[model samples]
Target: MRAAKSAYPLTWRIMDALEAFAAFVWPARFGRAIPWLMLAPALLLVGLLVLGLWLIGDASLRTLDTSTFLMSETYTLANYRRAFTESLFAVVAWRSLAGSLMVTAATLILAFPYAYVMVRTSSPVIRKLLLIALFLPFFIGQVVRAYGWLIILGNQGMVNEALSLVGIAPIRLLYNYWAVLFGLVQYMLPFAVLMLAPALTAIPEELEAAAGSLGADWLRTFRHVVLPLARPGLVGAGLVVLTLSLTDFAMPAILGGGSQDFIANAIYDQFFRTSDQGLGSTLALLLVATGSLLVGLVFTLFGAGTLAMGRARQ
Candidate 1:
């Protein structure tokens, strides 16, 4: 046995030594705890999050005493009421909700085809190029991307310059709702494509070929087969895009040029701009609740498959 151990490769010997040390430190009887032990960090993080939320909730119940520039001792729902009643807050909320829906729809529509081609295409070069394009923007910061759009869509930018050569005037493309939405869509496309790719890959090409052999057209095959199989990815991507867009700040701030603002921007204005921590806490809590409710709705309607694999089996 010693000779046999000595004959093993150096890498294997090291692995054996590590295993032996681990077994000695942690006995086999406690093996079941290993899973829970590994989860300790996550549990700690969740506990901290809950603690922070509790503190915020407590703060939200109190009102900011503007006269003294401090929070009041008595609890009140005034902050919550103000959030819903204020026209500025209401408009920002509506804009965020509307923008989120629009961005989600556009992202899914644009991403589905890109992801489908990336997964289904036989050409490695095209796949590589597509992957490169998708990930290249992902490496760049969202703030940087917003600034890039400003350069490209500005009055003196490349787009307007090209139009000038054709005897057209520079259009007001930047600093609007559409501009903010465009920035969000551009930022989210990669994430949507990434989420959808695995789902598309899971679909067997042989199924499509089989459908074709049975005289079904490509569109019919895709509608009846591929689309159904890819629902999990679609739902997941939609949820991700919706939540992100709803809470986005940088795009609206940078691209919308002070006129357009999302819910996150509103939250920021409360906390920092106006120095109203109570209102900020209320907004933050509401945003969390809204996101949680939306996610719960998706899960309730679509099952866990909206965020996981195994939807096809269901």
Candidate 2:
């Protein structure tokens, strides 16, 4: 009649040992350093990021010599110049940017209602169902979900079969600009709902009731009170969705069928397909800059909002 052992006894023992070892190494006077010690992992990650940036920047200045199939030793701005001047790059950049904006807007629009209903519903069953609907897709990997869309939207797939039942010919659905955007909006919807749910919860239901009591209709109350208060959440969700959509590689690659290209796909082509490290490095660095600039721009306009956990403005 022995008690069951801990599920991860070895891991627990190792952790305890590490704690003891850490305590042993520290001097009594260094007790005050515990706070700083907590930041070691973050500092290490930052150091690695800086190192990576330095490497990519160095590679970007070196052009690939097609003649020798090697990167040039001498640093030059040829890669940067080409990136700025190229029409292909411009097209890909524009597509990614525009798609990202559209996806963010559409996802937020769809997510707001979902989040509102989830937050406001009184019944536990409804709340659970909504949560399942919101989170189930997250468990499915992005690439897998993209493939699922392929199955549903394929010319000979379910939609086509349904169309055939009604005497309609099978139409092309996948591998188009709208298809890509549609997939992106679907992919980003869950993220938007997760972001917005908390913000909706933070708003007092009584205020909404009070608005209704004061002769304001549902539309007016939503427009003035709910909308204004939810601004932070919307901005935060929009920023997340925009950045993710802009940099997505799989959706554009798989769904576009090599026709539509995003900046990320372009970067992948440069690095892997073309075997041009210089060009790839240039694109990677520019992508980082673009994403940073966008985030900075959002912060400047919206004051960081819920992305900063409602404490940014405070």
Estimate the overall C-alpha local distance difference test score of candidate 1: 0.92
- Model 1 scores a TM of 0.91
For residues 8-124, write the lDDT of model 2, one tens digit per residue: 588888999998888789967799988889999999999999999999999999999889989998999999999999999999998999999899999999999999999999999
lDDT per prediction? 0.92, 0.92
lDDT of 1 by residue, 1-314 (tens): 35765578899988999999999999899999999999999999999999999999998998888899899899999999999899988898889889999999999999999999999889999999999999999789999999999899999999999999999999999999999999999999999999899889989999999999999999999999999989888988999898999899999999999999998998899889888999999999998998889889988887655476564465
For residue 179, model 2's alpha carbon misses the true position, in angstroms, by: 0.5
After best superposition, candidate 1 residue 202: deviation in angstroms? 0.6
Worst 10 residues of 2 by lDDT: 1-10
TM-score of 2: 0.91
Model 1 RMSD vs true structure: 3.0
